[model samples]
Structure formats: C-alpha cells, structure tokens
Target: MKRLILGIFSIICMVTANSVQAQDKGPEFSKLDVSPMDLAIYRNDKDQPVVRVIYSRPQKRDREVFGKLVPYGKVWRTGANEATEITFYQDMKIADETVKAGTYTLYTIPEEKEWTVILNKKTNTWGAYEYSEKEDIVRIKVPVRKAPNNIEALSMAFEKANNGADLLIGWDDRYVKVPFKTAK
Candidate 1:
C-alpha cells in the first residue's frame, strides 16, 4: 500500500517537471532591431484632441519603388519585411470619420492618379503577396504628390499637428500624401 502511494507521487512529480522543462525549451528570441508602429495624440487649435499613425522601417535603396515594379491599383503589404501594421489606443476618426481603438493591417494601392490607403481587420501578414481582400477593414483615398528631391528608397512618416497629422509616404523621387483627423 505504501509503495503504491509512493510510486504515484513520484510519477506526478516527474510529469510536472517534464511539462515545465518542455515549456522552457520553447523558441528563444534574440535581440532584434525591428521597426514598430508609432501612434500618438495631440491637440488642435480649438483644443480638440487628434490622433496620428506613424509607420517606420529601415530604409533600403536599390529596391523597387512602390507603384512602379510593385505596380499600381493592387494591394501592397505597406512594408519591406512584414505586412504593415498600426495600433490605435484611443478612438479616432480618419478622413473625418470614427474608428475604434485596435490593431490593424495597413495596405496601399499605388497609382499615377491617386493612392488609396487601406486599414484592414487582419493583422500580421507576411506581405501583399498573401493579402486577402476579405480582411480589409476600411479604405481611404489619398492623393499623390511628387517629391522635390529623389528619395531612391521607400519610407513613411507621420508629422503631428495641432489637429491631425500628415501621412507622408515617399519613395524614389515621388511622394504620396494623406491626412487623418479625429471625428467629433
């Protein structure tokens, strides 16, 4: 009787220890200098709060500028390595409408006429190569503009303002412009 009880106890202890060991042996993360989304809020002249979305990545040259080799009127992953992603901590309006606070995938349609920026429900996709139309959350049409100097690389930035921000996308001597403002 005592021997049986001791055997069961030992088995339980060994199983618990093995489970812990397995968990500890899971994937290890290294120091990765990865780009992340930058979101912020500020006030406008009327003291109204505004929201902003900033997407940044390491700049690379010799790569194909979007809309040319990347093509126009198609979904773009919006980033180099990973599908572009954005997070909004607070409720904000884009293009004079309201959107909830959440994480979203960002896509773009590059065209000679104008560019379309899309906010999608799905998050964390590899690139536009695997983009699915069903995952799109919202689409906003933004205008395209030419840059003064040649960029030769793809980059995006959001400049905070009193009421909103300027969504500036630049690549290879061209640029696209967009503005996001909070709805009342």
Candidate 2:
C-alpha cells in the first residue's frame, strides 16, 4: 500500500512539473504584425454603445498595401487573423439601405478610387477564404481619399454626424467613410 501511494505521488509530481514548464513559456508572439488587437465602439448620447467592432490591426511593414497586398476588385478580410466583426445594437440605415440589428463580418473590395464596403451576415470566419456574396446584408460604395499622413496600422473609427455617424476605415495612406443613420 505504501509503494502504491509513492507511485501515485510521483506521477502527480511529474504532471505538476510539466505544467509549470509550459506556463513558464508565457504568451506566444505574433510575427509580422505588431499592432495588437483592438476594439472600436460608437455610443449614443445616452452613453450606450450602438455600434461595436472587434479587429486585429496589421502593420504596413513597408509593403505596398492597396492594389497589391489587398488586390483591387477582390474581397478582403478587412483585418488580419480572424475576419473583423461588427455589431449593431439597433436597426440602422446604411447608405440609405436598412440593416437589422445583428453581428456581421465586415469585408471590403479595394479599388484605386473607390471601395465597396460590405456587411455580411456570416460571422466568425478566418480571412476572406469563405466569403459569400449571398450572405451580404449591405453593400455600399465609398470614395477612397489620401491620408494626410501614413497610418502604420489598420484602424476603424466612428465619427458623430447629424443623425448618426460615419464609420471610417484607415490604413497606410488611404481611408474610406461609410455613412449610417439610426432607423426611426
């Protein structure tokens, strides 16, 4: 009985040691991208967040962004790793088209002068490998503008407007704004 107890104790000790070693390794580092994960929230005057977006920012890293890394007329995941996701707390009119309140995957088709911003019903996708046009909830064309300065990392922001707000996507030296208004 004593020998059996000793054997069990030894096995437990080995497992504990191995677990400690694994924990010591700490978090894994991401290669190529150093911008970190980020969240953008747009709140109403009452301090309630009406819109939220979760995304991972990828650095330019000296590589050409538009028309190359993200080819023109092709669907882009809009961010690195997992496809960027957006949530609307209430029904809203995007580019004059009504969209129901729900979570969606945001994708884009980059062009030299304009971009097609897409809000797809599908969520939790990796990249644009599984994008489906049939799942799109809204597609809006927005003009691309030159940034006053280079933006190293990909970003999204909501700026207050008359009736609602403008969703801005910026990276490198380009940006596009999509208008949205709350449904009455």
Candidate topping lDDT: 2
Query: Least lDDT summed over 10 consecutive residues: which range in candidate 2?
Result: 28-37
The lDDT of each candidate is 0.69, 0.91
User: Cα-based RMSD of the predictions, in order?
Assistant: 9.2, 6.5
Q: Flag regions of model 1 displaced more than 4 Å.
A: 1-64
Worst 10 residues of 1 by lDDT: 33-42
TM value for model 2: 0.82
The C-alpha stretches of model 2 lying farther than 4 A from their native spots are 1-35
Per-residue C-alpha lDDT of model 2 across residues 1-184, encoded as one tens digit per residue = 9999999999999999999999899888768546577988899999998888899998899999998888999999998888999999999899778888889999999999999999999999999999999999899999999988899999899999877889889999999998888987
TM-score of each model, paired residue for residue: 0.65, 0.82
Q: Model 2: how far is 37 from its true place, Å? A: 1.8
lDDT assessment of candidate 1: 0.69
